[model samples]
Structure formats: structure tokens, C-alpha cells
Target chain A: MTPAEDYELPAGPGRNDNWQGVTPRQAFMRGMAVALTVPGIILFASAAGYGALARDAGFSLGNSVFMMGVFFALPAQVVLLDQIARGGSLMAGTLAVTLTGMRLLPMSVLLMPLLKGKRATRWRYLVAGHFIAVTAWMEGWRRLPLVPSELRMDHFIGIGTGLVLATLAGTWAGFELAGSVPHVVEAVLLLLTPIYFLLSLIASASGEADRLAIVLGGFLGPPLYVAFPGFDLLLAGIIGGSIARFVVRSRGTG
Target chain B: MTSSLHEVTQAAGAASGTLPTGLTLALILTVISLATHEPWRWLGLILGRNIDVDSELFRWVRAVSTALVAALVTRLVVFPAGALGGVPLLVRVLAMLCGLGVYLLFGRRISFGVVTAAVVLVAGQSIMGP
Candidate 1:
């Protein structure tokens, strides 16, 4: 086996409940299936909310859809949308989006290594990488480890494609249905993504170290925001994770 | 982009004066927009090229990512932005806590917990009013 394929997640011996015998076809289908579930519904709803908001902000349908297609990160899009809606210049919108997008750096860094397989080329990553937004990333984070090396790319592509389609449809609906859907309902839809992502993170944590990091990060996240506004996520990760690693090592538990 | 060559040239002259036409401008903007978020992925791929998945560094990366995501989710619930901002802080926090409580108490069913939280949030909002 090639070195990249030779590597495996450190699962305990006799861990049998993995995605064994999962062919690339099955993986892709399963990925699509995942996107049709609750998480996917939440994502679609939130995208609808974004679509309504952008429309109300006087963004053209083309501009809103194009933004969804490219700048898949919602937080950056939200900042830019809000900024522009308030009469901020493009440069100012750029600044806001850029600052909020810093969290994606770590996200990309973390997923890049995990997604690289023996046959996976840079082009595949370049195309699929754009779909590494919050919902897709969160779902991928929970599910990717179960995927085999060869099927990983296809599986992720399936999920990303389904999600993109869902979001695009949502944008159209919200843009068109902006008036009919109660403003309150659209706002409520926006709350689901964060809550869902949080629960998934807790659910999918693999071990003690991950759990510890989650605890520390959760405890420190709000307080740290006061100390450093935009950089809190990065700092919480570095400090909370480093401390978790050190603690786990010294205790001989990891 | 579909504009004629003459119009493209004129626009390019008006805008960049030296840079290529709309295509180059579009490419630059795409890169800048992606740069806000994608560098870490590229950097991670480069650095992780040689790193063992089972090593301490891998564990650290996983931990860091988990921490980062956890923090982000927490921040969203606590210091929410956009729509969630309309709801009172107390309601949001209580709803999150309720969800966390259910996730822990009920066989780790994330869906159940989230449903509970959503119901709580909506109930809290309506009862309390956004």
C-alpha cells in the first residue's frame, strides 16, 4: 500500500462498526442520503434565510446566488451582507468578511490532511475544497473517518453537491418567497445550523482528548471573545488543545 | 464578460489601465475572497504531507480543530449574530443548555437534543417575545 493509504485512524482493536465494504458508489449514495436528513434540512433552511436577507438587502438574485456559490462561508457572507446592507463599501465588506473568515484557515488546515488519499489529486481538492463550508464541514467531520481512503473524495463530493443544490434551491425559494415566509420564521431558521453543529461536535468527539478540548474551548470561548474579538477561535484551539494534549500525555491516558 | 472586445478594453483601461480585463479582476477577487479562509487548508496539506496520522501532531491538529469548532458553536449560541440576535440572550443560553442537557442525558441523540432546543427556543421566544 502507498504510505498515504497505509495510514489509519487509531481505532481500538476489534472496532467492527465502521464503513467497511463501502464502495465508492455506496459512499456517494450514502453521502447524498446524509444531505437529505435533518442536518441537510437545517442547512437548506438557513440558506433560505440568507437568501431572504440578501434579497431584502436589495441584492440581485444573481449576486446572492453567486456569493453562495463562491464564498461558501456563511459567517463571512453574513458580515459582508450586513456591512453592505448598511451602506458599507466593498473594501469595508472585504475587511469584515476577511476577518470573520480567519476561522476557516484552521478548518481548511485540519481537513486538508484528512481528505488527501492516494489517488486524490490537487485538482480534486481544489474543486471540492470550495464546498468546505460550515454545514458540509461539520457533517464531514462527523462522518469522514468512517470512509475508506479511495471513496473519501467521492463521498465528500456527493455530500457537497447535494448540499450546494439544496442551498441553491433554498436561495431561489427565499428570494422569491421572501414576502410570504414570516420574517420571524426565517430568522428562526438561521438558529438551527449553529445548534446542530454544536451537538454534532459533541456527538462525534472520538476520545478523551477531543472531549477535553471541547470542554476547555467551550468554557473559554465566550470569555476569550472579550479579550480578543475575531481571533478567539484560533486562540481557544491552540491553547485549549495544547493544554489538553499536554494533560493527556502526562496522565498517560491518550 | 460577454461584452465585446472593444468595450472590454475600454473598461479595462478605465479600471486597471495596466491589469488584464474582467477575467483577471474576477480571478483576483476570487483569490482574495478564498484567501480569507483557504490558506490554512493549503498550509496544512503542505505541512501534513510528511506528518504521520497516528502521531502526536495529528492528535494535536484534531484536538485543535475540535476546540476551534466547539468554541465557534459556543460563541454562536452565546454571543449570537444576525437572526439569533433578535432573541434575548437568556433564552438563547437556556435553550443551548437544555439541548446540551438532553444530549448528555438521552443516549447522545443529537437530533433529539436539537429538537428539544429548538422547541425551547421558539417557546422561549414567543413566550418572552424577540
Candidate 2:
């Protein structure tokens, strides 16, 4: 997507809000800058867990890194590993991965408004939409509101692009070290991912609906897995979210 | 679940170790996964065109995504496989709770929660001595 023009912010102090002089190039760099911080380190660590798992699952180091690089979404990649482990057919694996990938749609939908300025094209959004990594999307939601419109797309691309290194590098490192490390150490690393995901969800959750969804989904997920197996994640999410929404709406109406 | 599928996997497994890098299953997997994942982004371009960002429908969809992630994260904690499966179930559950407890107690300081959880998780395994 081509940058048409810049939207300058009124002078401010809390953030570097002077957008008048910042080019899309500069904003893109800023996005990269933000992603390479503590959050980036956390992402790298989480991805390292993925690396260890992938190697243990019998994926080649090259393949694991390649998956991390291309998929960029951690959970979907894990689903692929799950499929392989089950000796699932390719069609089954594709369906499961696609269901997981559906989460990206809402993520992109929420981001669209933030990425818009005067006369922005669908191409820009299409580009911005691809960088829909969970952390990237969450970080974008948290950070992009402050950004002037034209630069949001570039900045998001930068954030997503920069995080790619940490993920790929982490995956590579994990795969290479999988067997060399003590079993205990590898186990601990693998354990970090679920804990990290849980904590991040708790930390980032906002308002009643998110809280409700988290609670309901937590209750629903394991039981659904027993009954539905591969359909657990999708069913849990949809059912939990719908119930939460319905309850919230009913409360509002009453 | 079927014999043909089993045969396919057996064949693929047999070939995986020795296959040339150019034609490895990994390369094919990357292509297939990428192909499946790509259409959703484009689908976003289409759906995002008319959607109002703050509408209830939008929020509900967002809720669905968050719930899905929650389900996924918890499933890993609950029904773990692979390396994590080695850790006892009690250890995993406690690790999650301890992390969550500290995270909530510390005004949502993520690093504090993670570090606390990591300590519990690793320690739980050592204490279990398996």
C-alpha cells in the first residue's frame, strides 16, 4: 500500500506525538523499535518453547524455523504439530489450522479502523492484515490508537517484521538445543509457553466481556476436548464467546 | 483413522529422514500451511470493508478470538502432550494457578507472574522427582 499523505498530531508530551515530520519510513522504524524491547524478549522465549516442541515432534530444524517464519502465529503452528503427531490426514490438518486461523479475521477487522486515514486503500489494509500475530495485534491495539492514520499500517508491518527475527531465531535455537539440553531444562522451557499465554491473556484482558469469555472458555475447553477432540478450540471459543455476549446483552436490556 | 491414511503417514515418515532438502515434507508443509492461512487475510480485506469497528458484532467476534486463545492456552496446561506431558498434571495446574495468582496480585505485572510461575513449574517437577 502506497502512503498518500501524513496526518500530523498536535504537539504532545506523553508520547512522541509529533507526526508532522515522521515519514512512513520513520514510523515503520519506530514500530520495529518498539517490538525489539522486553515484549520482544518474551516473544522470543515463547517461540523457543515452540522450537523445543517442534524438534521433539520430529520436525527438522529447517522446517521448524520455516514454519515459525511463515505462519508467524504461534498457536496455529502448534496445531500443525498436533496434527502431525496424531498421524492426521492433510485435509484434517488443514481444517484445524484454518479454524485456528479464523481468529485472525476479527483481529484484522478490529485493526481496520485504526489503520485508516483520508482515502486509504484496501491494499494498505490487506498488507497490514497479514501481520496478524497475536502479540502484534494486541500490541497494535494498545499502541496504534495513538498513531496518526497513515503510519499505522507501516508501523504494524514493522512490528510484525521485526518480531519475525526473534521467533525464527528462537525456533532455530530451540531445535538445535533440544536434545543437548537436560531433559528437565527442555521440559521447563516447553512449560513456559502455556504459562506465558495464560498470563498475557489475563494481563491484556479488558472489560466484562473479555473476562467472561476467559472464564467460560476455560471451563468449556477441556470438557469439549473430551467430547469433540479436534473441534475443542473452535467450539469452546464460539460457545463461550456467544454465551458471554448473550449474558452481557441480556444484562444491558434488563 | 483409516488404513490409507496410516499407510500415507508411514510412507511419509519413512521418507522424511532421508528426503532431499529441496523436496522435503517440511517444504511441502510450509507451502500447504501458508496456502491455508493466506486466504483469511484476504477475507479480512473483504469483511473489514464495511464493518463498524465498535459495533456489538465486532466486539463479539473479538471475544470469540480471545476465548479461542484462552481455550488453547488452558488446553495446553490441562491436556498437555510432548515435553510438557512429562510434568505431572498437579504440577502443571499449580504452575498455572501460581502464575495467575501472582499476576493478579502484582497489579498485572507480567514478568513477575511468569517468573513466579516458572519457578513453581520447574520446582514442582523436581519435588515430584520424575
Candidate 3:
């Protein structure tokens, strides 16, 4: 076997639950099935909320659909929609979206190494990287250790595709239902995005760094938004994350 | 002449649509992913995987990602935009706490927590009448 393939194999005895004998088709199916679970549901709800908000902000249904398919990230899409609705210039909107997307940088860096096995070509990695949003990143982080390296990319792509399709459908549905839906129901739908994150933050935390960052960021986010409304998310994340990392490192846990 | 000029400017402003902005934002999101993700993966490939995965730099990268997402989530909760902002501050915080309580109590199943929070918000608004 090639060195890369050997490296891709899981160390020691493999878990019976790991995708040892699974084919690529099975891996993709596994990914798609995961989308029906909590992670996929949260993404769908958020995208639907984005769609409703976009429609309310005067975007055409097509535009709302396009945003979900293209931008994909809800926070960035929210910024873009809000800015456009408020009559901001294109340059300002673009900058805001780009800043929100900066969060993806770390996600990309983390997922890149995990996805690269013997079968990964340069193009394959790049394409797979497109699918590495919060849900994909967290799921991959949790699941990649168990997957055969050859199936990692396939599994990721399947989940990513499922996530994309879910978001798109949710957006379209929200756009359609925006006005007709009751205010309370609408409120519930819209609130799901934040609630999902909060719960995920508390539940998905796996390490000291994660817990510290979440606490620091949650504490700092409000004040920072009031102080620097435009760049608040970016500022809070960088500052809070840096502090958490430093603390972890100093304590020898990093 | 001044009245005519004002009318023309108003019409021009109304005619400007969000098409350009949507396309531009989409392009920017795509580019950000490509620029940030592609370079690192390629570098890892060239230099060998051990250095890339085991290094201190990658750890910091992950730490920052978690922080950013957490911060953004908090921002949405504390300083929500659009319709969510209409709910009173107390109500928002209480609802969030309710959801969080459920999340912790129920083994962190995200849907259960989110549902609890949403239910609280809707129920609170109904009882409180806003």
C-alpha cells in the first residue's frame, strides 16, 4: 500500500461501527441520512428564516433562493440582506459578507488535514472545502476519526450536498410562507437559528478551549456589538478566541 | 427646476435594486472559502500531513473558529436584527435561558432545546402580549 493510504488508515483496531467496508455510495447515503437529524434540521430552519427575512426585506423569491444556494452562510446572508434593505452601497454589503465569512477560515484550516487521504486530489479537497460550514465541520470533526480515509471526502460531500439542498428547500418554503404564516409561528421559526447555536454551543463543546471561547465570546459579543456594531462579530471572535487559546496554552492544555 | 431634480433623484433611488448586491455577496462568500481553505490544504499536502495537523498553528486556527461562531451566536441573541428585535429584552433572555436549561437537562439534543426556547418565546409573547 502507498504511504498516503497507510497513513489514512485508522490507527490500531478499528471500531466495528466505523465505515470499514462501506462503499462510496454508502458513505454518501450515510451523509444524506445525517441531514435528516438535528444538524440538518437546524440548518434548514435557519435557511428558511433567512429566506423569510430576505423576502420581507424586498428581495424577490428568486433572489432569496439564489442567496441560500450561493452565499450559503446565514450570518453573511443576513448582513447582505439587511444592508441592501437599508440602502447601503454594494461595496459595504460585500465587505460585510466577507468579514462574516472570515469565520470560515479556521473551519477550513481544521477540516483540510482531516479530509486529505490517499484518494484526495487538489481539486477534490477544494470542492469538499466548499461544503465545510458549521454543521459539516462539527459533524466531520466528530465522525472523521471513525471513517476510512478514502470515504472521508465522499461522506463530507454527501452531507454537504444534503445540507445545501435542505437549506435551499427551507429558504423557498420560508419565502412562500412568510406573509401567510402567523406572527407567533414566524417568530418561532426565526428564533430557531439562535436557539440552535446556543444549544449547540453548550452541548457540542468537547474541550477546554471550546468551552472557554464560548463563554468569552458570549460575554463579549453584546458589549462589542454595542461598541462596534459593524465589525462586532469579527472583533468578538478574534479577541475572544485569542484569549481562550492563550489561556489554554499557558495552562499547558493546548 | 429644484422640484423636478428632486423627483428625478427619488425615482433613481427607488429604481436601484438588490440584484447587484446579492450577486456580489455570493461571489465574496465563494472567494473567501477558496482563499482561506485551498492554500492551507495545498501547503499541508506539500509539507506532509504531520506538520500540518500536529502543529500549534492549526490548534489556534480551530480555537479562533469556535470563538467566532460562539461570538456570532451571542450577537444574534443579544442584539438580534429584524423581527426578533421586537421581542422585549427580558423575554429574549428568559426564553434563551429556558432553552438552555432544557438543553442541559435533556442531554444536549439541539432540537429539544431549540424547541423549548421557541415555545417559551411564543408562550411568553402570548401571555405578555408583545
Candidate 4:
């Protein structure tokens, strides 16, 4: 097994034991380096796409770029923009976008333990949670175990900073280009966001359960859309996840 | 219809032709939405003994979050926006599937999956029109 595959550290050290080896600063810098490479490009492209979509939907360059800085979550931003375009009530749009962001809560909770030091305070978690996007989460999952516990936070900060800066710059660039670009270019640009997502999913899938979840999710998600239309995402996710859990459980028992 | 267009232009000019106020409001809402997750994180800290954010509980959360994000992306692709909005949904879905299939068949390389999917999409769109 590879180094990533061989190690499987629990979220927290047993008792209050601090991790050894790397310092937070070094790890953070390493993470930043990684972010600047493959992940940075992806984030830039995705954010640019968001800018283009926001422009196409008739949002201002300033507002679109501003949202990228503040919200940071793309899916919720997309939902919010789409709802507003449809003349949906501000309250309704807010609620929908917020609901879409509900997933972040758990994600933050899960990542906190990995990066938190034995003596770490609540405030640290609160701040770090802001950087908890899919890219960071996956990187943390893979790299946190390898680094000395003390340095995980630094690694995360390094990566998170790179990602945030890249996203911010990309969003602004896309917004500026929105008006001048043709519609087809915008469509393809927007399409790149999802394409990046699909590719990332392939990269992150580990173990039978994860594989099962993706396969089930992929097969079931599209069909559910055909049947339930707008509600397919929620329904298909619930069904796929439950099935994957059940299969994993059965296999364990057997 | 002509009069309505004129009215829209007037409104657009008055608003500095910027994004609609409702969208700005929505943007504000998105910013503050970060608070919603606070309560849950705190709750986990308080009651869930040994439940650090990195605990199994959070791992499940991360997994679910990953899936949800994936689902949203898939939704956008399957039910696109603006110009490609007119492209047949099946074609988009097929392109994604083809890309995914190629990725899986090639040992699940991220670059391959993304590039192949993107190529398939552009190629399919060009050949099929729209």
C-alpha cells in the first residue's frame, strides 16, 4: 500500500497526545504549494465559470465578485443567483441557498478534529471551519494523518489561503469577461465547474463503501431526476447513501 | 411588449444597470449563511464525548457533504444554465457519463476524466449543433 493507504490515524490522538514530526508552518506551506499547483488551477477555472454565470444571469461584476469573497461556496451562490433571476423572493432565495449550505456544518465538524491541537481552543475551529471546502477537506483527509498533529493546522492554512486567493481572483476575472464573451463560452466555462467536481470525486474515492456510494449515487441520481425532477438530488442522495451504508454494514457483519 | 422593454431599460438605468437589488440581498444572505453551521459544531463539542471535529461523526459529515456538493454539480450539468440551457439534457448527461466511463476505464485519473469529459462535451456539441 502507498503511504496514504497504509496510515489510518483516528481523528483525535488517544487522550491528549500531540502529533510528532512536521510543524504546522511547514505543513501549511506544503499544502499551499500543492494548492498553487493542480487544485489552484481547478479552483480558478471553477470560480471564473461562476463569474461568467453570474454575469449571464444579469448580476453586476462588483456584486458577483463580492459574493465570491464573502460566500465562498459556489453551489449556494449558483442557487442564489438562479433564484433571483427567476424573480424569487429574497427571503426564499436566502433560505434555499442557506439550505444548500447545510452540508457545510457537518463537513466543518469532521475536519476540525483532524486539524485541532490537543490544547486548541474553540475559536481556532471556528476560524478554520471557514476554509472547509471540498478541496481542502479531501487534502486534509489525505495529508493530516501523515503530518505531525501539531502542524496539520499550518498545512491546512497554507492550502486554504492559496485556494481562497485563487478563487477570489478567478471570480473577478470571469465577471469582467462575462459581458465581452459569447454565450457558448460562458456555458462551457460554467460546465467546467461540474467537470472538475466529477474528476475530484474520482480522485477522492477510497475503500469499498466510498466506491459503492459513488456508483450508486451516479446511477441513481440521474434516474431519480427523470422521475422526481427537481427533488431528485435530495431523494437520490438519501437512497444512495442509505444503500451504501447498508451494504457496508452487511459486509462487515458477514 | 415594447413599452415593457422601455420600462425595463428605464429601471436598469436607474439601478445603474447593476445586478438587481434582490440579488444583492441574496448575496448578503449568502454571507451570513455561514452562521447556520455554528450551532451544530458547538453541539458536537458539548455533548458528543470524544467527538472531535475529526471524529467518525465528522467523517460521516464530510462524506455526506462531499456527496451533496457532487450532487449539486451534477444537477448543474444535467440541468444547465443560460445558452447551453437549450442543449438536450440527455446529451449533457451522456457526455458526463462518457467522461466518467473513460476515467474509470483508464484507472480513474483525474486529469484524464476531466479532459476527456470536456473534450466529449465540446465535440458532441459541435457535431450535434447547439
Model 4 misplaced regions, further than 4 Å = A1-29, A88-102, A118-121, A182-184, A201-254, B1-27, B30-32, B37-49, B52-71, B86-91
Model 3: lDDT of residue A78: 69
Off by over 4 Å in 3: A1-23, A79-121, A141-152, A203-206, A246-253, B1-65
Summing lDDT over every window of 10 consecutive residues in candidate 4 chain A, give the lowest-scoring window.
A1-10
Candidate 1 per-residue C-alpha lDDT over B16-129 given as tens digits, one digit per residue, 9 for 90 to 100: 444222455345446657666555445545554454555787678768766766776676667654455667778888888888898778766666776778788888888886
The best candidate by TM-score is 2
Task: Sort by TM-score, best first.
Answer: 2, 3, 4, 1
Q: What is the TM-score of each candidate against the true structure?
A: 0.63, 0.78, 0.74, 0.70
lDDT by residue for model 3 (A160-232), tens: 8888899999999887877687766666666776777656555545478868988888888778867865566
lDDT scores of the candidates, listed in order: 0.65, 0.71, 0.66, 0.60
Residue A81's lDDT within candidate 2 is 71
Task: Return the lDDT, model 4, position B53.
Answer: 41
User: Which ranges in model 1 have alpha carbons more than 4 Å from their true place?
Assistant: A1-34, A49-64, A71-156, A171-183, B1-29, B36-50
The global Cα lDDT (0 to 1) of model 2 is: 0.71
Stretches off by above 4 angstroms in model 2 are A1-20, A89-92, A117-125, A148-150, A203-210, A223-228, A238-254, B1-35, B52-67
Candidate 2: which pairs clash?
Answer: none
Each model's DockQ score: 0.23, 0.38, 0.29, 0.24
Chain A TM-score by candidate, in order: 0.66, 0.77, 0.75, 0.69
